[model samples]
Target: MIKSVIGLFLPVILALPLAAQEDSDVLFTVSGEPVTVGEFRYIYSKTNGQDADFSRASVMEYLDLYERFKLKVARAREMGLDTVVALQNELEGYRQQLADNYLLDKEVTDKLVSELYRRKQEDVDFSHILVSLPSLIPADTLAAYERAMDIRDGLTAGNFADRAAEVSDDAYSKNDGGHIGYVNAPLPGGMYRLEEAIYEAADGEVVGPVRTPAGYHLVLKHGSRPAYGEVEIAHILLRKSPEADPDMQKQRAEEARAALRNGESFEDVAAEYSEDDKTSRQGGYIGFFGINRYNKTFEEAAFGLSEDGEISEVIESPVGFHILKRISHRGIQPEAEQAPLLEAAVRQDTRFAEARKALFDRLEREYGTRKVDANYTSFVNGLDSTFFQLSTDLSAADRDATILEIGDQQYTTGDFVDYLEANARLRSSLERRFEVEGAAESLFDNWTDQQVERYAEAQLEEQFPEFKALMREYREGILLFEATKLEVWDRAGEDTTGLEAFFDAHRDQYRFPPRARVLKYTVNTAEGTDAQAVAQAAEKNTSAELIEEFGTDGLRIEEQVYEEATLPKGVTFKADTRSSVDQVDRNSAVFYRVVEMLPARQKELSEARGYVIADYQDQLERQWVEALRKKFAVKRNERVLAKLIES
Candidate 1:
């Protein structure tokens, strides 16, 4: 087993010195167990990838951290934390999720994603006629394909839309004469086949019986064009109340236009008058948006502006009139820059299933996934109607029957039944319309995909050394976390007597700066006009009394004890004084009367408990790490250390 594990990393192992390669390239030894260079580099890279702080650490600095880490793992294993049932279950669950990142056909995914990125640079507009059919019914499926093919045969540019409106099953597109609008490629969802067909066809050419989850489609390529990219706009809005007159709203919009013509800053005008609360505060700046994102009138007007700082005339929408100013426009980005986003979007889409199906088809051909036609038919027939009912127990004969053979692996009838039972709870309708042959065919296909993924996962460690290293790191990480929680974190929190003693010792270290116990109130006025009046009233009465006298409406009032350092910006004062000061903008003023002064002093244990506890935990962990280091016989090779420093 050890030799096999080492063999998985042969390529990397061969890069090391002959002595080191044969003996696993030992960088260090903890308690006589070797820590290989490959293992250290794997952890170093993983940590550095995720953490900016660690990425900046030099090899020597990281080596110390890594040594401490291995000591913890060693301690955890020695204490048998790795054998805990809950920890094992948690690790297994994490392993399953992590396996997905490693187990995929990445070369195939990357190629498809690249193809998608290239195509996304050009948008396609197509019209289609659908002939829907469920795949389980072979004859019906063929008939749908034939219908699509027939539609495609006679399709002409002029009649395509007319025929689509008359016969297409797509309700939304039918009314628009089968126009599905502009779609970005690799069409998301089970539309990969359609996307491929659309891209391959010339403008005005008819193509199809393209198969998708929605069934067969006869698609007419309307045209393709360079991407429109995205636009950013700033708009000045004049919101009209439902009760307000439309003419007045239009008049307000025109007034805003006049302000722009008169050379007033657009941002200033928007901030002073625009009624759109969302964008008004940001000087009416609407962030970048793609086509079809905004309402029709807004979208059209925003896109129509050709140059930065160009303003649109009054445009009417349901809300009111808007005056749009062009901010900027972006063309298609470089493929390398856009691929990550495109890949992520495509992977999450259901249409990507077609691409996955393509991969599966390729894998099946390569690995020899053979269905035992006779056994498959017999297995389906043998299943009772109760087989569809999730609650009903199934006693499948030939439970071990090889339904599918992928290379040396055989997927059994028992596996299919297991998948079906586990999945059928939410698919109760399957029981009502269950057909042995058809249901079996659909189930087998889905099961085959799962089996393929599992097979890929099993081979990952051997085929990809990085995957093995990563899994090993995660497994140890899990053990370390559980062990640390039990030994350090949980214990520190629970040791109240020790915690209280620690807090008392550190009380003098925690002190509050000079602060104020004060009465404060704020009043808004045009250019600080009411500043004197408000401050005068505050000096004579309490905040509540002032509020009552001032009728409570539109008066801003508050009273809080604040440290001098934590005071609201724009206000500055020494304690033990009454003062009234105008705001920075001179738009408002604050009134304050210092009731008392708070001198700098040591904080009470209760007041500093949270910080003190955190500090105490850190101290405890430092002691624990020291104890672990002493417990383990740690030895580092000077030669290997030198090599790391040189690298």
Candidate 2:
């Protein structure tokens, strides 16, 4: 059943019409808003749309929408919404917003190229035996030596996996024959010590008895990877629970099939039966995700299926009963989608390729030799001091033994450092962090990701043609929401008369959760300082003076407390203080005290006035954004929209 959809879709790929000029004459109007030919063509070029010459049918759909839009805008004018203070404020807000995008584009894009051009190729593939306890194998001895030797022999003899299956200690990799396959060139800088050991090995050679805080490792180099991108996939799933009996499940499935055959809803059946509560609530929607997002079994089954809405039969996975439905599949998932894996690969390749090519080109242009000069020795040796901490001090005298060559040109120490420093700068600029006390740099990036903002911007420009002049509509819409919120929603600003009336009308949502008042303190060590000195010191010093001198952030003295679950991480009940989102750190804390507990009580207007105002503003804005939709008569170009719909 699934095979047929793919068989059909593959042909559709071929039959994708050679988009013609007809698509251009097609006019799309949204409430008297004319979507120009240039705009349509440009949009189609960037997206998956029918780019044929515009036709009457194509243009008519847009015209209908344009009519409705005109009607709404006309109504808005009648209501004097254009002159509205809220509208003017909203337009001004987006003016700042649009201006910010240009600066952001330049900042992010300029940094991408210089950052890509750096480095060379040196990779490793190693395997290991990890013992979880450190002290057990600290001293190098015959026993530790013999154990590593034995593991080595087993690996060489094709039985290393069997031995690892029986006795290896690292919970992460022991079961898989000590296999942690090819990472790029060097292992990434931190986190996994075992990964580093593997990267430092030579091909077909055994290295290690390398000590980590966890245990000793004997990594053997096996292989490496050259260059390749990755792929992505998505699927819908049908799952069964452990409580389900095989016979009973099959029977229920048969009943479901009969219902489906009798014209019953697949959604209803899914809602009633799917064990996956998250997707089941949305009628079994899993949306788009990448490979490796699920277990090997689930990944295989879903990608192996084809076409949206095509469901599979009872397939066993670690997560139990599954009836997977294929939704969409993509190639080499977006860098951000499979970020940890894909971006790492791309970054390494970009650095190595750019660095190697530029160096090679420079050498050919200048020296023109197939054999490298002795100067490369100093260049290669210099890297030891520059890039890594070394056990042995390197000297100019030792340069004679080191032979470093790129094609015919020999690299000198100066050349090596030049490239090294250049690469280091690029890395710094791209990865530089401001070290926000609590907020993550990437979290802020994600917040600024313009997901909803871009959509709103595009639609606003489309809806209002003189949008530059009329943007006040959108800005005011947003600002009115903001201003109304500020007036009533200020944390410390609540009008008793207004709140009392609000409370009298809607008392249900105001009922408060059990809460408390917390005096919070957060102390942290600087980066790479893994020691817990502050946590340790807190036990000895509780004085506000000494504690203030200690590295802790002090939140409000009388901050409202929340339920234990309501408190974010780094916060907990203490005899004296509480934590908040502000208390973040790699280092743990000691004096986490809850100074006072406030019982859940009826919420007065004063207590919830801020929230009520915010809610009112949100409702008003939603109403306006919705009303804007009505003002513009809308028409969907389904023929042009096939791509998004199918995906």
Candidate 3:
């Protein structure tokens, strides 16, 4: 089934020369429409990948399938299913999803990845005193900058952490004296801009008043060192059960330790005694992990072991008692190999905002971006305190006022207002948290990014021909799905009268095999010699009375309907016959009675509706396809077909 479908719907492959061919280089034709070599090859390539069954299919075999497929698609087009509004909307949605894969600025991403890799080589330890400022409010930003500068001025040697604890707005590290421990570039927790600022400062020197989206910072670069990599470890745990004595946990751990000391295998000991169900089954292997993955105590102990097979003494954590063993440790990987990891980390990090801004800045310069300086200031002046509260609207004049010029395009105050309205909730939050002017400025840049991205996406077809080909294939696929539904699936499901007629015409194709109805009785005897009791139970006058007598002392009875071929082994009975057998166990006996017998018969229409409907649809589709084949003229190029096979 899978092979046949693959033969019919191959995907577009850029490397296939046939997919790039002109329409005049036709592979086949249906009716008056030509099926170009490109179309045929694109479909074929989808089913001709390294592991595809169609990779071994003959050109002629696939051509026959493709011809039928085209006939159906052509009929669908004639029926105008492609013009359906719902289908068009669905296709457009798919196009949007596909666009994401092609719309990114790859050049910028690659450059950032490479840049991050170079930075990842060295780890920097830094401290900072942050005075939070809103980006939009120039006044608040200025105040924050002054505060950072004053703090920088007062920073005596060895006093930066103390000042940071007292003054920094970063609650996470403020209480810890603002110490941001050894951050690698792209900044592990994504302080890329701060990392960059740290690199600019000499070791042990105080620097900046540097501005970030978060605030203005006074940085203290303590030192730098070669980057350290991750570690792999395993542990055997002895959990203290809530109702159990703590000493029992300690005793189990000691037993495990004694096993190891006595030269028993660590994996064997862990398998036998570790209380942690998850890792115990895997020989207590805890896999490779980086920093911050486990509790501080566990992490410290795991990393402390310097060599493989080295073990730590039994240690206790909040969860349980554990003994640790180092499996392996690795140093920093080569930058080239680490680029993808850094890129992924950066994308997920808020620090990517800085990199994104850098990209936008470059775009602005390339596109000759210009702000109408007077118009911007005038716009800001017109805004009142309620402006960010969603209580103000742009005046008619302000709506038309040009705020920015990029390349040959002009953006108005109206454009930015629309963006704000579209993201009203986010804008409201930012408004309450930060200064308004700086927020507006950042929003303007974001609006520009949308335009830039749209422009870039529009150029993709021209910039990359392969992307165009791929999209074309998806477009056809979307159309094909809608067309098939209308022509075959929906029609089959809704045509109840037609289905009944089809099923009636094919009644002889459905049947049932021989079957039987029987009762199986099991009786357990207290005396171990009660086969006579089972026989007497089968001979009872009333089922209820017989059950009351036999259904005691582990006795039970069950009735079932079954086909003759599916009846249980070693148990057989003729109609109206009853028999008993002594059990394999001395205390039990078995007996059965055939209640009735059923002969094979044809299944009713209602009984076979599900299977019949599908088969009927297949019959209808086949007839329709045959009619289409006769109406349309098909021509194949044998010479070109042979070339396809060779390729």
Candidate 4:
């Protein structure tokens, strides 16, 4: 197990660089390797927080500790621990973990999230004419795109609805002049592009030929309004009937409202007059509802109630009269409060994928990446029917052929094969349905995307200075942990002779305070046993002897040692004396008999092994650090140090 020495070293590895410094900014050197002022300042500021006042004493104290840390890291490098395969792999793993967050275009993601938040404040009323593609094959897609363009070229404010009704594939809205009602931001997954197009267009503006996963869409904006976020309402309903006049229902609703005005609780009025059996039991609660979930009349009346517990005037929808009481209303919150939700929504939506694709495309172009068409085709053609079963023998295949070139790195055919092997189940499934050529193409595209992403991740250290600094900190932390384990911790524990010697020297420091060895006895009075007899026997006999004599039937005895402070309250310590038996309850009695009272004494090495080993490790670390200081030459720039103190 790797015990962390990063915390022990304190301020050295705590913080990443705030900004890069020049060669002249070197604060000190350990074995000729410069430690920069910027690096020192960042770690010192972060570690001390408000106490980092740059006073001479504080700065010098931290600087001394940081210098020791650097010397240890230098020794680790000299030992060639950095070149060890396991440590190299661990460092790379950490780099990859950090890269995931740095790989995305934060500017683009933030803009998308902000736009979604702004659009969430209002609902857009729009209609779309979908030119449905029969399949996503190139021919079908091109035909759909062309047909959508032709329809868009002829579209205007007057004929859009008519054209949509004639040719649009959406059966739900085609017959209704293509109006799908008012929609808002975060329009379900796979429709983000459509949502963006509609929200971005002006009223009566014809937009799109915008392609979504569904098909191409020609959208017409029909204006927007402040969003009806959601409403929690309880309603009292009066259903219309064939036998009763509609006016009678309205009259009854008016009477119910009058009863509410006359100080009858809404729940009581609803239970008495509400016809909705499902909700009358719940005081006619419909819970919270957003726009378009309920009918226009019910939604408008419910949302129209401005204050909590305010009742609406009687509203009549297709079912009958509804009197709504608003429980609560939730509108759009401010951007800072809403950004997290909007960001989550954006990520779940397809737009996040689109943004990542844009990033990958930019990276590929910047790096001048190219696909080796001949090499890829050759590899794909070499696959046999066994490839579908993931049993193809690729050992004899030309593994060295370069399939892709990104910057100066060439990804070989063997690399692609390895990726395929890793995704064996997915590849086999794809091949079973689409066959080798099709599966090969799909997997190759995915592999290419991963390669591009990896390349971009590799560039992060060069592109972002803070990323480099962070990697350095983690690498050093790992090195320090391993170095300390080998130099201090393992030695302290394994060096039994050295541990005993150290313990002998510090024997007086490790001592047990005055303590009493006592035996507690309990007898269950319900068992009709003599409690006084049990206590008397416990004072002279071991627990095993008492258990044998009493046959272990509710006669219990336990021995323990307690120090003066830890002894039970109201109990006095006395050697060779038994306390008076006290009845614990109707069923039990308890008493303590002290066997022996011992004075303060030194602890054995075995008794204090843990504490002794810890102290020994600290001693070993200090000696090792002193040895390292001698082995490595440390030179400090006093001018920079004095300047830091003044600042």
Better of 1 and 4 by lDDT: 4
In candidate 3 the C-alpha lDDT for residue 92 amounts to 74
* Clashes (candidate 1): 3
Regions of candidate 3 where Cα sits further than 4 Å from its true position: 1-49, 53-63, 97-187, 191-231, 234-261, 264-287, 290-324, 327-344, 358-381, 398-412, 424-437, 454-474, 493-501, 518-561, 564-594, 632-640
Which is the better candidate, 1 or 2, if ranked by lDDT? 1
lDDT of 3 by residue, 1-647 (tens): 99977766665443355545643377777777877766676667676565433343655677788888888777767778778898778777876776673544364566667667776677788888888876567888788888887888768648988998888999988987888676656554645567779976789898887776788888888898776567888899998778867888988898898889999887998999998899998889998876556776887788788898898889888778898888999877887777777778767776566666676677668778788888877876776656567545645357888987877778788877788778766666777556877777767667778876665566666667567777766666776677767777788889999988988889988777776777777777654536665666566445567667555565667888777677766556457567546574666677777777778789898888888888987887888888888887888877776666666
Worst lDDT run of 10 residues, candidate 1, spans: 50-59
Model 2 spans with C-alpha error above 4 angstroms: 1-129, 133-150, 171-246, 253-268, 306-309, 333-647
* RMSD, every candidate, angstroms: 10.7, 25.0, 11.1, 8.9
Alpha-carbon deviation at 642 in model 3, angstroms: 3.3
Residue 119, candidate 2: alpha-carbon lDDT:
13
Best by lDDT: 4
* Per-residue lDDT of candidate 1, residues 282-313 (tens digit): 87998898665777688878878899879999
Local lDDT at 634 for model 1: 95
- What's the CA error at residue 316 for candidate 4, in Å? 5.5
TM-score of each: 0.59, 0.29, 0.59, 0.73
- Steric collisions counted per model: 3, 46, 7, 0
**Model 3's lDDT to the true fold?**
0.75
> In TM-score terms, which candidate is top?
4
Using TM-score as the yardstick, the better of models 2 and 4 is: 4
